[model samples]
Target: MEVMEIIKDAFVFPSKDMKTLLIYVLLSLVAAGFSFFGTVVYVLGFVNPECFMWGGMAVIISLLIGWVMYGYLISVIKSGIEQSDEVPGFEWWENFITGFNNFIVTIVYFVIPAFITVIVGYMTNVYGNAMIVAQEIYLQATYSYMGSSSAIAFDAIYQALVNLLFSLTITITVAVVVFVIFSFLQTMAEARLANTGSLSEALNVFEAAKDIRRIGIGKVIILVLLVIIIVAVIEMIFSALFSIIPILSILSIIIAPYLAFFAQRAVGLLYSDIA
Candidate 1:
């Protein structure tokens, strides 16, 4: 019921507050700063191959910085909602502390999921490639013999069907796994916001994800489809606009990191209201 409430709250009215938009923009800038620095380090490392020793360090540091910024932004959003006001006079030092807390939470949430994802991806790629290669070889061998085009055609069709099924299975499997993890994180963070203390309480909130899905799966599906359509149109428009002015295109890359956080915050706000 609370999950349904959250979905309804988030979906009924979708306009973003100007203040929240500004917060997202600011956060985007912060994230981009770290990303740019990381990119520079990456390029420099490759240019000077001996600089590879520091490459991992740079990546680790970049991830830490980015994580902290994201956490801080989320904390600020939570705080803002609690205070019933916009991030009460934006103190950078305070944000740093909040960000660090968020960064830690993020790593805890992601470690297992990332490992699982890598394993699944590796297995899927290996299997998928092997299937395709086997099919290709079979087709070649059949082609070289007895002029039996019909048999070869049937074999090709069978292989295609098998490959498609395998691909679909792998894709759907991964998607479901990742989405579940994401839903768990969303529920936890939003609950923590709702009950203003207890990280453990936040973790407990994820137990309700099944109920949330049960009640709101249709709505969630619709919302996802709508978002995809809207984003597609927006992307097309932006793409055309960028074609006219190349500089504007660069801004999209800069805003990319904030997009995920902003979307998450928006969804959380909607769900929290429902809860």
Candidate 2:
């Protein structure tokens, strides 16, 4: 199938069956609710420290929900590669373990860019700037929760790092480019893993690259570019739209997992030639 067709099909697939789409959206809402509960508890803990324990449990539950969602997405991709119209059903433990393995595979791919980001951060003292921003955010949160102003200690020192802003921007840009480049392999690896049901295939970069060769490098690159472009465009649109109608911003939350469905479907279709 052509890359454009694949993308179109992937984007439209989730909405092809309204019931399935609603189920996915309901799952997203459950995750969001638990996450919201955790946030509220953490903030309340600022007043009553005992609330922290419940906040921790809420966070754990939210993470578990996210993990299960990832497992189902793997199934979505599996269905896509098989060119099947059927929605894959959840297999509880199977989904959790597969999602965990996929998480490990993703972290493995992120190492190089993350290492470079760390090195650049250390050299430029960008981490100092990050710490300053974090402290400022914390102070604001404390003020909001406690109704008392908190000290902003590092603003003056942080301003000195304005000179490093260029270096920080370059670092982020380089990391994104490198990430996108590796994503081609990662996408291939993931599709193979989904197809073979083996974590080993996801780690086999050499084999993943071989699969890309079979799929055609030009086609793969275009697929990656298309996904990136669409994602960026939609992000911009949502940012602006949500800013205009802040209450409707909740729609973006619902849309997020559906976007994941679209991407994984494309990943499957992109590798469909070989799968």
Model number with the top TM-score: 2
Tens-digit lDDT track for model 1 on 83-182?
2323333345655555555555556566656666667766666466557767766876676686656665767667766766776578568867885756
Candidate 2 local Cα displacement, residue 95, angstroms: 1.9
Candidate 2 segments exceeding 4 Å error: 119-174, 234-254
CA lDDT, every prediction?
0.54, 0.81
10 residues in a row with least lDDT, candidate 2: 149-158
- C-alpha lDDT (0 to 100) for residue 71 of candidate 2: 75
Q: After superposition, how far is residue 137 of candidate 2 from its true place, in Å?
A: 25
Reference-based TM-score of each model: 0.56, 0.74
- Number of backbone-clashing residue pairs for each candidate, in the order shown: 3, 0
Clashing pairs in 2: none
- Candidate 2, number of clashes: 0
Q: What tens digits encode model 2's per-residue C-alpha lDDT throughout 35-130?
A: 999989988998999889898889889878777777778888898899887667778788888888888888888896688777876777777766
